[model samples]
Target: MIQKSFCAIFLFVLGLGPISLTAQSLEIDADLRARFEYRHGFNNLFPDNADPAAFVNQRSRLNFNYTTEKLQLFIAVQDVSIWGDTRQILAVDGNDSFSLFEAWGQIQMNENWYMKLGRQVLTYDDERIFGGLDWAMQGRFHDAALLKYRKDGFMMDLGGAYSQETDRNDGNDFRIQGFFTYKALQYAYLKKSWEKSSASFLFLNTGFQDFDVNDVADGVSYRHTTGTYFKFPIKIINVTGSLYYQFGKANATTDLAAYQMSLEATYKKNKVLYGLGLELLSGTDQDGAAKNNSFFPLYGTNHKFNGFMDYFYVGNHANTVGLNDFYAKMVFTTGEKSTVLVKGHYFTANAALTGDADAYLGTEMDLVYTQALMKNVNLNVGYSHMFASESMSLIKGGRPHDNTNNWGWIQLIINPNIFKADLGTPSN
Candidate 1:
C-alpha cells in the first residue's frame, strides 16, 4: 500500500504536465553522455598475459520541472546502456534500458525551511561519506525523503528512508527482517562555512534484514557511522582534515568497531598547486575468527580517494583489513583552458602483519590532462602505473608481478542544454 501511495503521488505530479503547459510553468532538462573506457591492469593483480578491454558506455536523461511560488515538482528519467549491447534498430525490452532516476516534490514551508519527499539523490560535503558517484557511467541515487534548512552558507539536512521486500506474491516474507542498506537508512548532515574555513558533520545508520535459520524467522541489524570534516586556509597553504568512526552490530552478528582519519595540505602558487596527504583506517586482525574491526565508507564515492586505480578499499577488500595511503600531487595549468595533474600514491595495510608480510606495500603514479574543446565539450586523458613490492604482492592476493602494472583511458564529455521554457521571463 505504501509503494502504491508513493507511485500515485509521482504519477499525479507527472499528470500536472497539461496544467503546466497552460500555465507556462514547465521546464525541461536533458543530458547525453557517452564515454569510451579502456581497461588494462586497472585493478592490479591481473592474470597472466591478459588483454586490454575497451567499451563505450552511455547515459541519457530527461527531466521535467514545474515550479510555483510555494512548491516544486521534479521528475527525472534516464536510460543507460552499453554500446552494442542490444539491437539499435529494434524497440524491445532488450534495448529498453530505462529507469526512474529521480522523482520528488518539494514544499517550501518558509524562507529557511523546505521538505522534499520521494526518490532522490543525497550529495553532501566533499563527497567523502556521502556522494552521488557521478564518475560511474550510471551514477548513484537513493530513495529518501529529505528536510533541508539553509541560511547563507550554513546548512543542515536530516533525511531518512526505509525499505522492505514489496513482492506481494511472497506474502510470507513481506516485511522488514533486517536493517541493511536494502532495508533502512537514516542520516543527518550539518555544515557551516566561514570566510576562509568550513566544517561539516555526518551521522549515518543502516539497518540490514536477515532471516534466522534456527528460529525460522527474520530480524534486522543496525550499524552506525559518523564523521566530521574541516578545512581552513593558512596564508598560502590550505589544510583539510577528517575523522570517522564506525560502530554497532554488523549484519553478520559481529561486534563492529573501527575508525579512520586523514589530513591533507595544498599550496598554490600562480598556476601550479602542490598537495600532500595521509589517510589511515583501522582494521581487524584476521588471525583467527576474531570480531570485525574494519570500517566501511558506506554510500561514499570511493573512486575519488586512495587512488584513481580503485585498488584499495573500493571493492572486494571492503571490511577486510584497514588501509593507509600516503600520497602527493602537483597540478599545472597548461593555458587558460587546460590543466595537467600528476600524482603519486604509496599504500600499506594498517593492521598488524603476519609472517613474511611487511608494511611496505607499493607505489602508484597518475598523470591526467583535461582541456576544454567547445563551450560545452571537454577532453580528459589519464594514465597510471603501479610498482608493487614483494610485500605488496602478498597483501594484494600475491598475483603475478612480472609485468609493469599500467592503465590508460581517455574520455570526452559533451554537455548541451536541449530545451528550455521559462514562464517568468521570456527572451527575445
Candidate 2:
C-alpha cells in the first residue's frame, strides 16, 4: 500500500533523531555501483553469428538527509539488477528493480524564496536540456513543483508537472507507457554568474497523450523547448555554447520544428586536457517527411553525448536522420589517482539520405580509464570502436563494414557516508 506508506513515513522521520529547530542536521548515505559489459557492437550493428553480450549490472543506494532552519529533506532508495537476473531463492523481486530514487522537500520562503516539492532532480545548465540521468541505473526523476530563486550570483527556477494514471474519478488520461512519457510539465530556469562568465536559460513544456484509433484518450500534445547555455574564458581557452529550439506539436499529427547547436573548446596544461567539439541535430529525411524535424536531446545525458557506443540518442534515434557530431578529446594524467581519456567521432547525416544512401555516417573511438579506489572508492575502464559506413550500414542494421564494431566496459564505484548528526545550537 504505497510502499507501506513510504515505510511508515520513513520510520517516522528516522525516529525524529536530530532536531533542534533552528540548527538541525542529519545525513546518511550510500551508493554502490557495479558494471561489466562486453557487447559486440554495443548499441547496434554486429551481426553475423551473434553471441556476445556478457553482463553484470548493479546499483544500490540509500540516502536520507534532513536539515532545518526552514526545512529541507531528501530520501532515496534504489536497486537495479542484472546479475543472474535474481533467483537465489526469491519470494518476489524477479526484476522490477526496486525504486524510489528521490523524494524531495525544500521550504524556505523568504530571503530569496524557495519551495521545492517531491521527487526532484532536474539538473540545468550545460546539461543540454535538464539532466540527472546519472549514468542510468534507474536515475532520473521529476514529479515536480518548484519555485526557487537565489541571490547574488543569480538563479531562478519555476517548474510544474502533472501526470495521472491512478486515483481516478475524472479524466486526464496519462496512461503511462514509456519511451518518454509526459502528460504535462512546464519549466523555466535562469542563471547568471560572473567573475569569469556564465549564462543559462531554458523554457520547456511537454505534454503528450493523444491517442485515438480506438485507443481513446485524445487530447494533449504540446512540445516546446527553448534554450541557451554558455560559459566563457579565452586567455587559455575554455569556452562552451549551446542553443536549442523545438516547436510545438510532435504528436497528434506531427508538426514540430527542431534545432540544436553546440560548440566547445578546452585547454589545460600541466597534466594535459585538450578538446574541441561541434554538434548539430535537426533532421528528417529518408523520404517520409510530413512534418517533424528531428532534434531530440530530450532529457539530456544521452550517454554524455554522441559517442560511448550508444549509437545516437541512447534510446534509438527518434524521428531519424539527425546528428552531425565532430569531435576530439584528450585528458591524460595517469597518476595520483589516475586518469586518461581519448576520444574522437565524426559522424554525419543531418538530413537527406536514402537514395544511393551515404551521408557519411561512421567513425568513433573512445577510451577511458580512471582510478581513485579510495575515500569512497572508484575505478572505471572502457573501450569503444565503430567505423562503419555505407551510411552506417544504411541506418544501423548490421554488416556493411562491421569488423566487429566494438565495446567493452568495467566500472565500480562506492560512495559512503553512512551517518552524521549535529543538533547543536539552542541553549539557555
Candidate 3:
C-alpha cells in the first residue's frame, strides 16, 4: 500500500506536466501526522492506583479524487498506529492499523441538486452537534446517503444511514464497530449566509440496538435531537451561539427531555484576539423516574469543548448531571509565523449534585503555542492544569486524588499533495 501524506503545498510537486483540454481532473491528497505525548495526569487526576503513561501515535492517509462535469469519485486509505508496534502491519482483517477510511461518489442531479453515497465525513456550522472529529487518529466517518441542494446563499442536505443487526462480518456490509454505531439514522441540515452573518438548523434521528428484557421484544432505542447554530459580527465584536433540544425515548423504557445552550463573544484588535464564552447542558434530575434530562451531543466534536483535558461530555459524561462552563480566552501573535493562546475555565453542575457535593465544580487553565515550520508543516505545544473540587471528586466516583493537576503535549502536522493530473482546457 502507498500512502501520500503531507500539506497542500506538496501537491505542486505531484502535478502532471501535460494535460488535455477535456476539462477533467484527477488529484491525490495525503496527510501525515505524528505526535508524541507524555502525561503524569492526562484525562483526569489518576486515582493513585494507576501510573503515568506515554505514547507516540501517528496517522497516515492517501486519497484519490476524480471529477467530471456531472460525476465525482473519491477513495481514501488510511493507517493509524503507535510507534514500535511492528515493522509490518497485517491489515487483512478489520482493525485500526489499516483500512479504507472513505469511499464515496457523487452525481449532480440538476442545476442545484446533488446526491452522494458511501462512507464519508459530515460536518456543519461550528461542529457543535455534528462533526468529523479529525483530531483523532482514526477520525470519524459514516456509511450513508446524502441528498443536497444549493442555490445562491442557501443550502440544504438530507441524509440517511443503516447498519447491520450484528457485529459479525457477514457476506456483505461492514460491521461499523457494532455497538459503537446506530442501527438507523436520518437527518436534515439547512444553512443560509448573508454579508456579515450566517445561521444553520439541523434535525437528527438515531436508533441503536439493545438487548430485550425477556429476549422476546424489540431492542431498538430511539432519540431525536434538533438544534441551531448562528454567528454575526457587530462592530468590533463577533457573536456566536448555539442551542439544541433532545426529546423522545432514549431507549424502549427510558424517556428523555434534555437540552444544551452556548454563547460566545470575541474581539480582534492589533495582534491579539480575546474571547469569552459559556456553555450549559442539562442533566437528569436525581429525583426523576419520570424522564431522563441528561443531554448528549451524540456526533459532535466533544474534544473541542468544556476543557482541552476533555474531563467532561466527551464519551462517558452521558446521563449524569451535566455541566456549566464559563470561559475566557486570548490569542497573541508573535511575528508572522507563530501565535500563543491562553484560556481559563470555571465549571459547575447544570443541575443538582450527588452526595454532599456543592454546585461548585472546579477551574482549569490551558496554554498553547504554535509555529509554522514550513509551507505545510507546523509544530504545536500545549499545557493544561485542572483544579478539582468536592463535586468533581464525587462525580468522578473517586476521592480527589492529587492527580487532576496538570498535563502537557506536543504535536507535529504535515500535509502535502502527492500527485495531480489534469485533462481538458487548463485554467492557466
Top of the candidates by lDDT: 2
Candidate 2 lDDT by residue in tens digits, 1-428:
33564466567666665444477777878898999989887778888876888898988877788788888889888778888797876766767787788889898889899998899778887666788988888878888999999999999898998888789678877778687679888888888999998888888999889989999899999989988898899899999988899998888888999999999899999998999999999989977788899989888778888899988988888888898999999999989998999999999999988885778888889999999988998989999988877677767754556557898889998998978887565444
Worst 10 residues of 2 by lDDT: 1-10
Estimate the TM-score for candidate 1.
0.88
Lowest lDDT sum, 10 consecutive residues, model 1, at 171-180
Per residue, candidate 1 scores C-alpha lDDT tens digits across 50-99 of: 78778888877666777766678888777788888986665454755777
TM-score of 3: 0.89
Candidate 1 residue-wise lDDT at 201: 91
Cα-based lDDT at residue 149, candidate 3? 97
Where does the lowest 10-residue lDDT sum fall in candidate 3?
Answer: 1-10
Per-residue lDDT of candidate 3, residues 10-47 (tens digit): 35323533333346777887788898877755566667
Please list all clashing residue pairs in model 2, or write none if there are none. Answer: none
Local error of candidate 2 at residue 188 (angstroms): 5.9
From the highest lDDT down, the ranking of the candidates is 2, 3, 1
